[model samples]
Target: MFDDVIQEDVLLEMKYVYDYVKIETAFPKYATKKALQKYSSPTLLFAAENDVFFPSKLIVPRSEQIFSNLTKTVILQNSSHMQNNANINKILTEIEYFFSN
Candidate 1:
């Protein structure tokens, strides 16, 4: 099996996350004050200004209030959840900037 082929210690574990899943599933459990207080870290919460599922007007402020340590926020003025060319480029730039310093 794939798990056996690579040594557990040698293989880095990564999980693909869908934002909708967080909103629907995890949020109910983890979006409480106690949960936020438990896991405090530097966070970069990005929201699309034009996102249909999660608009920046809502998500940005909510994230800022919830996360104990929010490093930055970059909202693409005219973007959606799909991360189109303009949004992708903007996000990529923010990511590069985040890791550089």
Candidate 2:
């Protein structure tokens, strides 16, 4: 009975994701290599210094290589994958600066 309930939950979740993806397909999807070659717009990368999901060290250099028009990288010091209010404020500030400049 428990297994059946779990399977139903999983199927429901999968259907939700599939529906969401179908709706999202209206936007352009770019492969990393293709985006690197094709994209030529200014871009800013805000990286959390202490992010567990995506380490700054790995993401920074890889982004630098990929983004032809890379503008800047703002490192949010002592931050993790899930940001606090302070981090959100910092991110907003960085975005404002990026757009203004």
Reference-based TM-score, model 2:
0.65
Give a tens-digit lDDT track for model 1, residues 1-101: 12123434433331223422353443343375567797866677788777776789988878877887889988877666655555567788888888887
Q: Which stretches of candidate 2 lie over 4 Å from their true place?
A: 1-34
Which regions of candidate 1 fall more than 4 Å away from where they truly are? 1-30
TM-score on alpha carbons, each prediction: 0.65, 0.65
| lDDT of candidate model 2 versus the reference | 0.73
With a 3 Å backbone cut-off (N, CA, C), the pairs that clash in candidate 2 are: none
Candidate 2 has its poorest 10 consecutive residues by lDDT at: 1-10
Where does candidate 1 have its weakest 10-residue lDDT segment?
1-10
